[model samples]
Target: MSINDHRLVQCNEKDEETLLIFKKGINDSYNGKISTWSTKKDCCAWEGVSCDNITGRVTELDLKQHFLEGEMNMSILKLEFLSYLDLSFNEFDVIRIPSIQDNITHTSNLLYLDLSFNSYVSSLSLAWLSAHSSLKYLNLSGIDLHKETNLLQAVNTLPSLLELHLSECNLNNFITNPFMEYLNLSSLLTLDLSKNNFSSQLPNQFFNQTKDLTYLDLSWNNIHGSIPHSWKNMKYLDYINLWSNKLSGEALVHLSGWKQLRIMNLGENEFSGTIPINMSQILKVVILRANQFEGNIPTQIFNLSYLFHLDLADNKLSGSIPKSVYNLTQMIKFTMNDRTMAVVELFTKGQEYEVQQIETNRQTIDLSANYLSGEVPSELFHLVQLQTLNLSRNNLIGTIPKIIGGMKNLESLDLSNNKLCGEIPQSMSLLNFLEYLNISYNNFNGKIPTGTQLQSFNASSYIGNPKLCGAPLENCNIKEQNPKTPTTSMKNEDGDSIRESLYLGMGVGFAAGFWGICGSLFLIRKWRHAYFRFVDGVGDKLNVTLMVKLNRFH
Candidate 1:
């Protein structure tokens, strides 16, 4: 054979030959269009190159984000000393796909391999990587593997895999036998399969199989059904997100098993019933909105000492503001929207006033469009970092609190469709960050608050009160002569009362009027009879005198 081949065959080559193999592999990535170095010695001087501190052997090749391009070189694949290889995010794209048939056979010492976020990696299979006997870390996320066969077979090759990320890989169908056959990721600590189309209900034995899983995300899928009771067995699980699915049923209880859990997003589901009491203590960012849940606000739920964002909007929850909620001192975002199944819209429902140390970190609270009646809770002003306050579409009465101006960072305020009376608070104008304000459909009667922000608000923001006169309405602005005039009030009231009394007296005196008419007629009849009788007598007397004269004549 050749002289170098003789030296390699005899095991007489120097230690520098191993690094040359890696350098040559770097050259293959450019397809001979570019060099790995300006001069030959720069290959050893590369940033991520690591020679074993003992053997001077090139054991690591980490060229992350170095603007490298094209398929990995076949000539450099002959390196047998590489232990850690990370070629992630280096603009890897090629017109023609590369084949590893010859390259994978030569380089055999590779353990940790990461080729993530590259466009060139479209179709992958475990069979292709079957020869990598020592691989432990394999991250192929953001690679867009469309078909199943490529990845299913490829992932089964690494027996010592400790970390694997197949997120956003478009994998949904039931992964069968040969796919998971050799895949025993017992050492795996993190597995992210998020945003995939995996619709099948996960096997109940899933968590039981993965005892070491720490951070797992199966979120943004179509997986439904109740949270498995065995889910708590994943003792090492910390970050779990199954959000944006079709899951239903009551809240998962005793999340204490996942006591270290940091981020949990179970929102956008059909989960019904009350929020579980104990889960509040373990969560940091809890999102459970747009579900079918109902019942009273659990007082202990507000005790989540680490809550930063809590979203439970569009669920059927009731009761007034429990002063216990202020215990979530770090809460920055909280929403309770459009489900009026509550008793008191505000605090008048005799909310037990146990004001915990209010966390000035709260940025948003939305309890809008609920059956929440009574007055708006004055305790709401305790949220100094409040950014958005939406309490619209409730039976809430009373005046808008002037203390709202204390929320200097408030950007949106919506108090529409309430029974609130009194004038719009001029203190509202002090909110410099307020961009959207809707306070319509209230009984507030007084002068419209005037300022640059107030003037910009249209008349629609101040509708629904007839007594509210001095607005932009042309007829309402001109001062009237009748300023709470007394004469008009007395006349209107007296005339109304007199008409009512006359109708009542007419109905009651109907019999009296009839008897008076009948008695008067009877008296008149008697008088007529007596007068006629007198006349007849006078006539008779005259006639008698005539008759006597006539009789005497006869």
Candidate 2:
């Protein structure tokens, strides 16, 4: 055989035997995944295997989520040239986690290892991990690490580690050694210790050495107390989530130093005091809901040009919504192309929804369940791209603005449980995309506006407003006044009788006067003759006076 043929033949012998051994350990049901792993073909051509082009040695094995059921065979580490190995998300019945001490020489070339989500691996001892000094990425998430005592210290030995995920590992021992103040993994960029039983104050200096960390999630833990001032050194942080913890105090003042921060979630905590005023301007998501924050929503928040999701719900905040909310130019026009911005829990459509991927046009402003008062700002309607607007459970008053229809993208709206009144604006019916609406328990009056979208809601949406009527409610009716008894009808008849009596009395007085003058003269003949003789004598006296004057003038 020629030299090239001899080299190719030599590369396939040992590694191929090791791979066939790894395959035999798994149940026969998953044979299809490695069906091509036969002695006839070179091992480098097998499925889920990659070999270095020149050396013809297997370098990567990726069988993630293949549902291969079997006990882990530690002999796979015998792939001396392997650099990457992922056997995650499989039904491994038992895992004999490797202690690098037993096979140090075989694992020196390994760089990436992911054995995450193998729940059957009940116990872990990371002391063995210190042997893999060249390891960079390690994910043991969803594995039971309660029995592991040296998790932090062993992980710290990995100087080249860039990302570590131990979430849902039931890790309760936060600091195994009180003297170990800071982690030694200075090259780490991402760390997720969430969904663990970390019931202690945030270690003051635990993160001091990881100044380059850009993402940190300690959410879903019992971690209490204020954020340590030492954390301000992590200026490169881009996202931090401490949600569903007992963390408290007004120490958010330290957040202003994180100029690179973009997303912050402290929801469901005991955090009190006003929201920090000097928040980073480039922040895209701010979720401080269900806390003890009391005070006006700082007007400075509206100045954040890139803010798209602002949730201050279920706080004690008081005061009118700032009219400056219209200044959210990004929410009005800008499209957030990054779909993985942040996972948010929002109260919209009268319920809480855990949103995993915020769509490009999904802008939300949730200020519900506060002591806020004043008319809903008309200027707020300028956010035409907004999808969820929840201003419910407040003291808001006045009519819904006609411009509300301009927010055409609204999918969930709640103006319920307020003092808002007047006809639900006809413009509101123009919101064709509206899916969930609640205007109940308000002073609103007039027919609920007509539209398939508006009328599609249940009558409960229009309840508590006695005067609000239309489809989805009782029709408007004009009620007439009724007389209680005949007395009221008789009063009308008595008015007519008084008018007839007054006319009769006036006729009698005129007839009596006529009889007293002419009738008496006719009846009494002697008095009549005296009246006529007196009349004739006056007439003759006037005629004689006129003749005497005429004769004198002539």
Candidate 3:
């Protein structure tokens, strides 16, 4: 032990000695935070240290996101009374996880341990965790665990564990039998195995033991095959995320009985077939984007009163958007990407980014790049909470809803690449929050709306609409024509008016060209003299030609 360790151990009280050792370890490790830890002050009041009321012993040490660096010395293991330890979100890149296998058995009372976001941790470091029989919550997210082959086996040793998060751990394979054993533990409720390289399909009996599972995330893994019907056994499940996988076959039917399910995300998969009409009524979110599901959306889906998020984009689903969707006042997110399923993104600070979930009440609807036809239903505007709307790359026709302004919260709108005709809705000017607007490649005529928000959009928003004109585009009508000339007005009242406008535009163009040359000559003395000389030569030649013709005739 060093001089500092000796001083820490010199505390008169046993509890004080334990805390002093812990404090010394923290101070010696890094300096980003925990400056409040000093022997002059009560250890109980030190930052991130919590003491038991009756025993006056430190029970918890939470230094999460403190930017702490350097090696984690074993001095912390001296806290025999410590029950919780969180050193998450710190810069421990230079420190390998201390081999605690020899010492953890002495500190078996620890119930919670979170070392998440410490990138230097390795797979072997986790073996010591199994020694703590009392451990309930373990989060090792963002750790390098590629070499740990018996992850499930190690976790199974902690029967008291309730929530295990190993996300972003570089986990490649798992022992299915051990995982099943871990799942069988009645205490386990949440498990996150996301962002791994698990390429194998899930065992058919994987969920057989997950009776108490409430939250399960297997997203961003290389797992393949159809979803097992056995998952229906987990009646207590509330959240299931299998996003960005190779899951195929018609798996929605197996989930129909998940009455307790709240959020179900099977997006970015290979599942095909129509969405089940008889899904769980209690579902709050349903994301099935980027699949091959075809046919009309089931009307029963709109009846899900509790459903808020429905992402069926990037699929082959056909038919018009159901108007009954207006009933979902709880709707916060809805998407159907017009491009490929994977290209949907959110814009923030003028930057494009993807979101795993929506945390706000901003309503969104995207039905772009589909075969749906017909005019956009006016009832859609009835969703007063509506925010973003996209109906681009479809076969829909007819003018936009005149009362779209009713959606007071509208922000982004994309109506590009369709056969929509007629003037844009003037009520669109009422969209105060509108930030992005794209109505290009449509048959729309007349002037683009001139709202501050509307005019802020780039000219690309109105491109391909030849007849549409305004700022962001050419002016609706240029008034530079000569007053005496019969010019055409670009008014759409009648066919005759359109013809006259065309003729008038041509005449104005001709007069402007003629005067442009004449004015240039008059403005410059040299050019004026050159112009006169050329004109006189031409006149003399013309007169000589006329005289010659007359003489020949005589």
lDDT of 3 at 238: 79
**Model 1, range 1-554, lDDT digits (tens) per residue?**
11121121222134345445434534344433335333444333445665554444556767777667655543343456777878787666532223545444564787888877766667554454666767777777667676655565566566677777776677776333334534556677777777777776666555565777776767677888887777867777766667677887774563657667766666667877766666625555565656777766666766675664455555676666455336655543444321211111121111212121222243445565455667776666656556666777767787877887777777767788878898767887788877777777888776766567665666776667665654452235444423556887799899999999999999769867886766565679876677779889999999999999999998
lDDT of 3 by residue, 208-287 (tens): 66777688889888889887777868888878888888989988877767788877878788999878778888876677
**lDDT values for all models:** 0.62, 0.81, 0.72
Per-model TM values vs. the true structure: 0.64, 0.79, 0.77
After superposition, which runs of candidate 1 have C-alpha atoms over 4 Å from their true positions?
A: 1-37, 44-114, 119-121, 128-137, 150-162, 174-183, 254-256, 331-374, 390-399, 412-422, 435-554
Choose 1 or 3, whichever is better by TM-score: 3
Residue 336 local lDDT, model 1:
35
> Could you tell me which 10 consecutive residues in candidate 1 have the lowest summed lDDT?
340-349
In TM-score terms, candidate 2 sits at 0.79
The model with the greatest lDDT is 2
Clashes of 1: 11
Model 3 scores worst on lDDT over the 10 consecutive residues at 1-10
lDDT of 2 by residue, 1-554 (tens): 11233234335567877888788777647556665567786667676887776877777888888777877776687788888989898878677655546464654677899988876778766666776778888888898988777777788789999888888999777644564575675788888888897888877666876788688888889988888888878888988888899999885777878889888888999998887778887888888988999989888888788888888999999999888655676678866466654556766667777775665566889999999999887778888888889999999998888899898889999888999998888888999998898889999887777889898989988899987888889877653123236797688789889988999988998899998888989999998999999999999999999999999999
